[model samples]
Each structure stands twice: as C-alpha cells, then as structure tokens.
Target chain A: MQASMSCRPKWGICKMNQDLIQYLLRLGDSALIQGQRLCEWCGRAPALEEELALMNVGLDLVGQARNWLEYAAELANDGRDADHLAFRRDERAYRNLLLVEQPNGDFAVTVLKQFFYDAWHLAVLEGLTHSSDSRLQGIAAKAVKEVTYHLRRSSEWVERLGDGTEESHQRMLAAIPQLWRFTVELSDSDAVEQRLHAAGLIGDPQQIAAAWQQQVERTFDSATLPLPAPACHFYLSGRQGLHSEHLGLLLAEMQFLPRAYPDATW
Target chain B: MQPGDLIASDLGARAAAPGDLDQAWQVLGRVMDPEVPVVSVVELGIVRALAWDAGHLHVVVTPTYSGCPATEVIEADIRQALEDAGFRAPQLERQLHPAWTTDWITSTGRERLLAYGIAPPLGSANKRSLLGDNGSVNCPQCGSAHTELLSQFGSTACKALYRCCDCREPFDYFKCI
Candidate 1:
C-alpha cells in the first residue's frame, strides 16, 4: 500500500527511501507543535516577563520548524510549502513527540516538560552538528545555541519551584511523574533512525538518551525532587506519526484559520 | 565597440554604473530594519551576497533569527529597495546554511544597536553559551557592567531583557545567537 502524500510512514518501518524527508519532519513537527503549545500561553502566562519569554521561545521553535519543513517540502516534492505542511495535515500525519502535545497543566508542568525536552534537544542537536549531511549539521549547530539558552531558563525555574515553597515544590513533584512516561519514546530508535544512524547523518539515539539522563538526574537532584523510575511500558511511537489524543484537537485549532479561509496570509 | 564589447556595455548600462555595486551597497545601507529602524539589514550582515549574474543582479540574504518575524518583510524590503534604485528584477535568494549569528552583526551594526538602546552581544554565541559562562556585558545606556537580567527575552526575539544597576535603565541585550 502506498503512503499518502501528506502522511509520513508508520512507526518502526518506512519502506520509502525518503529517509531525509522523514527525519526532517520528525525534527520539524516536534518544534512546530511545541511552538504552538507555547503560543497557547501567549497572553495567559503567569507574568509579563514570562509571557514575552515563552512567546519568543515559541517563535524560535516555529522558526526552526519552518527551516526543517521547508527542506522537507523540497524532499517530498509534493508541491507543499511549510504553511501547508504545518496547517493542512491531520493528527495522524503529525510526527511530534507526545511530550510536546501534553497540555501545559501549570507553571510547574510547563517547566518540567520544557526542562526534559530542552536537555534532549540540546544533546541531539549537539550530536547532529557532526552529521555527514551539511544541512542537518548547520541547522543543528544553530539550534544548539538556542536550545542551550532554553534549557538554562527552564532548569532554573525547575530549581526555583522545586526549592521555593511547599506549594511550588508539591506542584513540581506532581508534574514530573505524569510526564516522565512520555519521554521514553524520545530516543527509542526505529528502522528509519537505525538506517540514518548507520549513515552518520543522525545522532546515536542511545547516546543522546544517556546525555539527557545525566542532565535530568542532575536537575532532579538539585531541584530536590525525587527521580521517578523510568517507564516499564514505553508508549513507543510518536516518530511515525503516531501521537496521543491531544494532537487531533491541537491540529483542529491550529489549522482553523488556514482551513476556514484557504490561502489566508498572516 | 566590438560585438562582445557592445553586449557588455549594454548590460552595464542596464544594470548600473561601473560603481553601481558600490551604489547598491549604499542603497542597502539606507534601507533600515522595520523593527529597529536604526540599522540597515546590510549592517546587520543579513545581506550576504550581491552580484551580477547572467546580466541580472542577484542578492543573497541569510535571514537572521531562525523564525524571526521580520525575515520575509525584510526580504521584501530589500527587493523593493533594489528595484527602486533601478536594478530591475534583481534576483533575491534567501540562503539558510550556516544560519545567522550575532557575531555577523558588524561593528557598525553594534554601534547602531547601542545608539538604539540595545546592547550588542558580548562575545561569540557558542563560547558565551557553553554550560556556564555569563561574561561581562556592559550596559549600553551608561556603559555600566553592573546589569541584571530581568528576563531571558526582551522586546524582540533576538534580545534579552537587562536592567543596568548603575544607570537604573532597562535595556535590550541582543542575544548571541
């Protein structure tokens, strides 16, 4: 059976040779959806400074999404631009991690989610900077800088809330356990990643996960939060466009303006 | 003039004077960034390449800030400015490789940023960003080194909010990346 033009491959198996495009979409969708989540906080963040910071970070990820998606469009050769790829796809076509799509439950939740994601982002990008693919290397190099700053900000918040007060600490503690399960899929390699890993175009998933583990352990230790045991049953498949129930609702809202008024320029 | 000489002369006349490349740079210099309004894109090192190709002018630009809101508008502005300066249908190619960095901002760009109340980056983006390194960043307002970070982000995506303790003036520090 032929894969649809818009939808990427199913998890653990992609028969098509369009590996680079698939890889790019994996990277792109995560950033794009993450950015969208942050945009949800545009006017609603706890403080004015936090509002500006979240929006800026959202813009950064969206920008990176544009970069990756633009390149993916070229590889896909389906005449779809970044806008179409972002706003026209169904949730089944989305390749973002489930961790990103999870609701921003509270400030504690946002901080924990961001800290976890940032560590992985920085580690993966750092490894990708040495990729045989020049485009991947360049994008990774540039992103490393941005995500470094992101990790710092989020981790500081993690520490602040963890060590702050009874309420803040309790909230952070509650936020971690629920979100920890989703991180398992982060570095769980599929056939696509395996092939790319062999070619030296993508980072080693194990190594990247290890780096993130070190960072997470350190942050949790400092935050005075207990590290939850890694999930025994990993929900192992967001990379192949398999996502949580949250994604469909997200795509509905994100695609609204574009779907309602086709070719709407904003 | 010989036939080849004639072709060259006609193309040159159509493009601009022999020094029109210089004139093109001048035109670029005058086109201020919409957001900052003080520094031109050329000064900021976003305009990477400018030349005549196949009897047409081609301008290559690397948009600064990965998802900077101003990327497209700035590109449009560049195209419009070049057309207004008589370089008709000049090609504009937006390249993304090696991504834009704060290090690319020229000394002139730094001065313009300072004058515009935005502090320039202290050093290279990579070095300043390594796990722990908050280098000395003197305030653009009062040239004070005693500045505190109010927020990681400022008025724009490329800046951080900083308040100068000495002058007590809040300012924007253009982030290294």
Candidate 2:
C-alpha cells in the first residue's frame, strides 16, 4: 500500500502483521535460486576480478534471501522459522520467478537474467522503504544499497556484452528472448499482492511495473539490445506451490541433509 | 617526546594497567550480532582491539566485509554494552587493515560456529583464495582434506559454500580474508 504522511501506530502493527508470506516468498526464492545460479561461476569465471565481483553479487542476493525469508517466516506465523522456510520447502512450494530458476547458461545469460531481476527488484525495494511497516522499511533500506551495486554491475556487463564483439553481441541478444517471457509475471497483480498493497506492506504492482519498464528500456537502449515482442505470461505460480521442473533438482541438492537427518541439530 | 618514546610509554602504560580493554572485551563479547543472535561480536572478529586511552575506551572495529550492513547495528550495540558497563559513552573507531581474517577466530569460536550449523574457517594452513592460486580448503567439522568449494560466496559475503566428502555436509565456511 502507498505510505501516507498520517501516522497511525495501530495501523502500522496491523498492517505489518498482514499474511503476505507468499509475496515475501516470491522475493526470497528469487534471490535464493538466483544466488545458486550465480554460484555456478565461483571458480570458473573468465577473469579473476570478475570472479570476485560475480561472487560478491551472489552473496548480496543470498543475504537478501535470508532477510526476506526471515520476514516470510514471521508472516507465515505457523511456527516456521527462516531455516525451516528456506530448507524445508518442497519444489512446488518455492515462489521464485521463472527467470531466476533458469540455469545459468553462460556469462551473457547470467548477466541478462540479473539485469532484468535487478531492475524490478531495485524498484520494488525502493518503494518498500516508505512502507508504514517499520521492519519492511528497515530491511528495504539495507537492501537498497546492495541492490544498487548489483544493478550497476549487471548494467555494465549488459553494455559490454551487447556492444563488444559480434559473438558476444549475438549471445547477449539471444539471452534476452530466453528470459524475456518470464518478465510478465513480475507485473501481474494477484491476491497476495492485493492483500499486501491494502495493508501497506508493499507498493502497487502497476507502479513497480511502470518503473521497471522504463529502467529496462533505458538499459536495453544502452546495451544495444532490443526488447522481445509481447508474449503470453510465463507463470510458474510459485506462490501457490506450483513450480517448474528445475526446482525439484535444486531442492534435492539444498534440502538433502536436513531431510535425511530429520530434527538433527549441530 | 620522541615517537619511539611515545610508543613505549603507551605500551608500558598498557602493560601496567589492563585498563578498559579487558573489561570492554568481556562486555562486548556479550553483544550479539543483530542478525545472528547466536554469534558474539568477538566471535565475528569485528572487534579488533579495545583500548583505554585518554581516560576513554577506544574500540577498533573492522567490518566483516567492505559494505557489511551490520556494522552500524554492531557499533550501536557495542556502545550500549559499554555504557551499561558504567562508561558514560565509549569512543569507537573503525580499523580496516590488516583486515579482519577468519584466521583470527578463536578455537572456541570455531567450535561454536560448527555447533551453530555454519562451518568454521579452514585453518590458515588450508585456506587460500582466488586472489592466490592455492585450491586448498578443509572441512572444519571432520578435518577432511577432501572438501570441495561449492560456491565462492555463501549465505553472506563473508562465507563460502563448502562440501565435506567425509561427513557429506554442505556448509558455509567463514571465508579467509
């Protein structure tokens, strides 16, 4: 919901307690899955500095995931802690965007994926900073710094790959169509978003979508990449626990230990 | 006063009276990391030195990473802890170099980290970075030399994902500086 200048502590508490676990999960899973994708480049980056830089971005996303997941756990209020929410979720239960879970095909593809997500995420985070809910506002304030850097890093790579050699340009161009179909879901306002918006836990999806489109167009212009034609929405329905095929394998790898040794603590 | 004499006086004064440093260490150790309540500031290796000089407590803190968000919260916690310990307000300064290293982690701290479900740093002997060409990192839990790095970054910037072959657990090892 859009933040108003009027201060009502009662509303803040009530609004903060809104059940937006699905919405928060969307944020958390996007970062968590994308962090996994970025980690694929750990020791294999084309350049050493670039390796550190890429890992840096990956770390930021993982940290962001932890923050959002913790909040999501609170929002769920079913005694699920952040660890439980993150590690115990089934493949179908993950609420990440389709683009984030896509395999990191190549450096160009990874950059394109990041550019798209960062543009949307940064705008969303910026909007959240004014939330009537203090916790979300606090989290957003901290995340904005990290997301800003992430945007800068991805933007630079987009430019380099788009304007570099012919091969790189072609690769960058190809990566766009591969990921562009998934962008539509980012703007799709559904029940969870509606609840969050009414409670002032989040901004209107339309506003975020408009800002995202402008930023995306500007970045594409700079990168010399063209926007893909509009297509049917590629929805994964991660909020309702429906997901693509990739999440199962990811969960298998991530949740193996905890599931195998149930209730085991260090 | 000669520079060396000033340094010696400072060192002599330090040796004669432990000052607020020992007290500060004890008090600050009680300050938990805001995000990870299980970890203390000392365990995080953020509080590098606690000195009592000019009738005030000086705490030199090195951030976990260049842009770690917890620094401000940690600093506030440190000040509050010291104030609670009877110093009106402590003087805090941040030091960035010889940057804080996971190598500085105490043995007890390492054990705590493992118990907390995050892997401890590989010993200095086993630690290497991409900045260098040595690919040796050990699993802190099992002492298995057969560990592979899963990710250069982990849940946080200060960590790396590592999988131990012997124990077969993927963990976030606090990365070496």
Candidate 3:
C-alpha cells in the first residue's frame, strides 16, 4: 500500500496495476454483499413474484461480482477464482460500500436501499463503459444494461411505496434517512479510486456523484418522499475494508458452507 | 467434503485436462435445463465455449438470466456429464460481459422453447428500452400473438406471467430483455 500512496501527481503504472485488484474488489464486494443480503429472502419475500424478483436482482449482482472478481484474480495473477475472492475473505477484508451491506430492514427499507445503490450503480457503470481497459469496458457495457432494469424496478417500488399508503409512506420515509448517509461515501473518492482514475481504468467519481444526485432527486420527487438532510458525521465508508457489525453476521452465514466444505462443488 | 482440492493454493492453476472437447460438447448436448427439461443447455446457448487449459477441460457458460436459479444446476450437470464421459476435472468459467441476451438463443433453441409451452423472447437484447415491456407476444400454447402480461415476473426468475386471449390459458412468457 505504500507504493499506492505515491499515486496522486502521476501514478506509477506498476503500482496502479497492483492497486487494480483492490479497485476491482471495491466494485465486486459491493455486488457480492448486496447479493448475499438479497439472497436471504429467497423464500421469505412478501409474495411469490416479489420473491423471484428479489432473488433475480440478487443473482444479477452476484453475476456482476463474479465477473469483476474473476478479472481481479486475473489481474492479481494469483490463481484465485471469484468464489475464493467472495467466500474466503474475512468481514474486515471486504471493500463493499457501506450502503449495500446495511441489513435489509423492512420491505420498504430494502427497496429504498436498492434504489439508492442502483442510482449510483447506473452512473458509475455508464461512465465505466468507456474505460481505457478493454476488460472494464466490456464488463461495464454488459452490466449497464442489467443495472438499468434494476434501477427501473427499484425506482418504481419507491414511487409506489412513497405515494401509496400511510404505513408505506412512513416506512419509506424512515428508511430514507437510515440509508442516506451511506450514499455519501459512494461518490467520495479514496486513494485507490484516484489511482484508477489516473490510469483511465475507471471514470471520475465526481461525475457519477453529480448524475446520482440528479437522478435521485428526480426519483424522490415522483416518490413523493422528501430527501434527507445532507452529510452528517455518519460517513460510513466500507471501501478500505471497514464495515458495520452487521457484516460479520452476514458473512458468517454465507461463508459457513463454503468454508466448511472448501472445494466442494455442487 | 474434501476441502484439500478446493483450497485456494493451487486454485489458480488450470485443472488437469484431457482436451476431449468434442466428447464434452456431445455430453453437454444431452444435459437439459433443469427447469425446462426438454431443452439442452447448448440449445439454450448457455455453454459459450469449451477449451483445454492446464490439461483440464475448461468451459465458458453464461446463464440465460443473471438470476436464473438453474445456473448452478446447469453447471453441475455439465461437469457431471463431462466427468461421466471420462474427462478429468473440467473447469467452468462464468463470463458476464457481452451479457447473455435473448438474442443468443439459437433458432433451434427457439423452436424447442416454443414447443415447451413458454413463448420465446421477441426482441433482440441490443434494443432494450426500459419501459417497453408490452410488446406483442405469441402464446406458445395457442400460437396467438394476443397475449397479455399478468405480471412482469413468472414462477421462475427468467420468465413473465402472461395469459393468452385466444386460448384463455395462463402461461409463461420468456420476456424479451
């Protein structure tokens, strides 16, 4: 990481290439974490259609994560596959944004969190399509299409929940502030992100932030829900592997069978 | 479960190979989709590639839908089929880029799908407009273009619930992405 510290002015290609694994992890971790959270609702969603939809969204994220982590493993050249990258890591080693790993509280909370994440996901993925790295470009080109549908579904739910009923409105409003702070860390670029930007491996997070804000505001207006106050000290950035207590519990469950069974394939 | 082979140490090394890809493809052709038993994975176009690496057979597979539950089952079936056909350990690589769109569904695959009572996806994946969910869909049961989507989601992740006007029967519409 010391080599990575010397990044800002002009990043060393070798060092930036090394940081590429971490960059991929940051992206992959978010998807993997969200997928794990959503997969928990496989049989528990309120309705059958909703259940399949939730599981599908989770699957899409996991699929994206598998692509990213597989690429990351290739970049690291360490021979580990995506599954190892996903289930083998400890909780503290994960680099997902704080937003995704937040527990799926109520149905409203889950939908709102997804909407928030998808909003940022779209902004970032669209910019990523033009990455100088052909691998990133290809993945982004494929992923942007998937996330577009994801955002549409989540945004529709936000609108219905926010405008539908007294209970649904309150639940949606309550979940907004609960998860809003996590969105701040999404656009806040860290050192690794800066290096990837310098290398043209990824897009500028600032532009993504601007797009995310515009889209979120438009969505909130239609949802009839007031956006929460901006930036309190609750900045929970999971980028550097720091995460909430909830992550550990989630990991314990997901990694259990994998860790126990090791190389066992289905 | 034997954890030693699955451990991460030599995990990156290519699996042992026989390079028997022709036999592997033949085996794969017989591995049907778990949900739709009539159609094989190859027909579904999910098995993207078969190659030899590190003396082990490597396969590239892309599921029809990202959230399709049968992804795991299909992979297992492919592995088991190849292994049963006397190949050594086969490696499966999942690629999401150039994501699997309905366009990848082969013409033969489309026929198999239609015969299976699920309407096939109508449009190409490239022209994906967000809200255009209501395109004219032919009912597989009646071959009627007059079909109404009852729900955007079906019993499984990759389908939509629809009812046909001509046949007055509820069926699954393999949605165009």
Give candidate 2's root-mean-square deviation (CA, Å): 14.2
Query: Highest lDDT: which candidate?
Result: 1
Q: Give per-residue CA lDDT, model 3, range B78-131, as digits (tens).
A: 877766665566688987666677777788888888888888878776545445
| Tens-digit lDDT track of model 1 for B114-136 | 98889888777674553437586
Which scores greater on DockQ, model 1 or model 3? 1
Q: For each candidate, what TM-score against the reference?
A: 0.91, 0.61, 0.81
Model 2 spans with C-alpha error above 4 angstroms: A1-18, A263-266, B1-177
Model 2 Cα displacement at A180 (Å)?
1.1
lDDT of 3 by residue, A1-266 (tens): 44446554565566777678888898899998899999988889999779878877888788889878988888666667888888999988899988898999999999998998999898888889989988898788777877887887899889999999999999998998788877777657778788788778788988988888888889899989997665554534587777888899999999999999988886
Over the stretch A105-223, how does candidate 1's per-residue lDDT look in tens digits? 99999888888889888888888889998888888777777888889889899999998999999999899887989988765667878888888888998898899889988988899
DockQ computed for model 2 against the true two-chain complex using alpha carbons: 0.06
Tell me which residue pairs clash in candidate 3: A79-B12, A263-B6, B16-B55, B16-B56, B17-B55, B17-B56
Candidate 3 whole-model C-alpha lDDT, 0 to 1: 0.80
Q: How high is the lDDT of residue A54 in model 1?
A: 93
Error of 1 at B163 (Å): 1.0
For candidate 3, the per-residue lDDT at A86 reads 88
**Top candidate, metric TM-score:** 1
- Residue B145 lDDT, candidate 1, scale 0-100: 91
In model 2, chain B matches the true chain B with a TM-score of 0.72
Native contact recovery (fnat) for each candidate is 0.69, 0.06, 0.45
lDDT tens digits, residue span A181-226, model 2: 7787666668768778887778888899888888888878888888
Whole-model lDDT per candidate: 0.83, 0.73, 0.80
